[model samples]
Target: MSAAPLTLTVATPLRVWFDAVEIVSLRAEDASGSFGIRPGHADCVTLLAPSVVRWTCTDGTTRYCAVDGGVLLVSRGVRISIACREAISGDSLESLEAGVRSRHAEEDDAARRARVEQLQLHARAVRQMLRYLRPHPGGGADGPDGPGIGANPR
Candidate 1:
């Protein structure tokens, strides 16, 4: 006898990847750990990790999706919805792995760029502060030795 079918939908920040797909089983990774979802399972919610979510289509074909992190909601153990920042679909495990690795590398590069920009902003702030606190060239009131900004009155 054929297995029962469950409807699946995966939504990301950009758009929806899956729309009412009929699947026989689902496998995913959450904070609690890896788990499986089958027809007639209890209704629940899971916080997905950066991993691949696999499922068996009604035709018995396996499919996969790469999710960085997100929430998966199951309603009545039949309708499943996933919300995430990023999600990509693949027809095979190898393709999913490649997609995930590429995305991970992109994120790392973006993070490095952000760190460099932050350091440059900090350097500019420090230079401006130094200019304001430095002694005036003419030893005027603004000088540190004078009775003005940053001056030491003894």
Candidate 2:
């Protein structure tokens, strides 16, 4: 007897990319490496990496969806759901791969820029604080040579 056909759904927070599509099998990757799911696979949850989810349709055509890290849930041995931050679906694997790579690179650049900005802001705040704490050079009560925090009492 043949295995039952599986239903696949790929969704993002803003939209559903694939909804209740009937597929013969599904393949995806996580930190643990690549894995496949059939109709009667065990129910479980896995954390997907920033990679492609490939599946075969009942008509023997293969499709792909690239995700930006998400969660995959298998339920009732027939339903497979993927919830990702972002998703890009395509019929051409080559184009899909290129698009995913470009998206990932853009995100990496943005994150790097944000971190640099944060560090600059932190450095600026520290400089301002140090300037406020430094003793004035004019040699008075609050000067570097007087009787205050940074001065030697004589």
Candidate 3:
């Protein structure tokens, strides 16, 4: 079967990358619960969480990305615009993995650390919603007061 085409727009620091690819899966929050969108989905808008987004290339290569928090707009023709705090492209999985590791190593001072802590709280709430909406591979939903999605959930 031919793969369905979708537009993915990623916004980051001072730049936005737009690409057309085959959308493998999309998970977002709706009023009812978390919902997944595939090809030919209805046009809608919803809040997104800090979670992994997976997609497949025409060559059957699957890629993964991490989205912090954002708004997702999906149109009938598979056009999606994601206005997110951060989006890590799935291309070059090794490089992406390494980048994530390097990013985690940087430590901020007191004030910045406080702000990050606050953001982490918000991210955690989003993650919980995601879990409730769509449970991940091997676990139950996180507690309400659990750490943020990207934070150390200890």
Q: On residues 76-147, what C-alpha lDDT tens digit does candidate 3 reach at each position?
A: 758877777776765766767766655555534556888999999999999867765553444443446654
TM-score per prediction, in order, is 0.76, 0.67, 0.54
Global lDDT of each model?
A: 0.87, 0.90, 0.66
lDDT value for candidate 2? 0.90
Off by over 4 Å in 1: 1-4, 31-33, 140-147, 150-154
Clashing pairs in 1: none
> In angstroms, how far off is 93's CA in candidate 1?
1.6
Ranking by lDDT: 2, 1, 3
Q: Among these predicted structures, which one has the highest lDDT?
A: 2
Off by over 4 Å in 3: 1-4, 22-35, 91-97, 107-154
Compared with the true structure, what per-residue lDDT tens digits does model 2 show for residues 1-154? 8988999999998999999999999999999999999989999999999888999999999999998899999999999999999999888899898887787799999999999999999999998767656766754235343355655455
| Order by TM-score, highest first | 1, 2, 3
**Considering only N, C-alpha and C atoms within 3 Å, which residue pairs clash in candidate 3?**
124-148
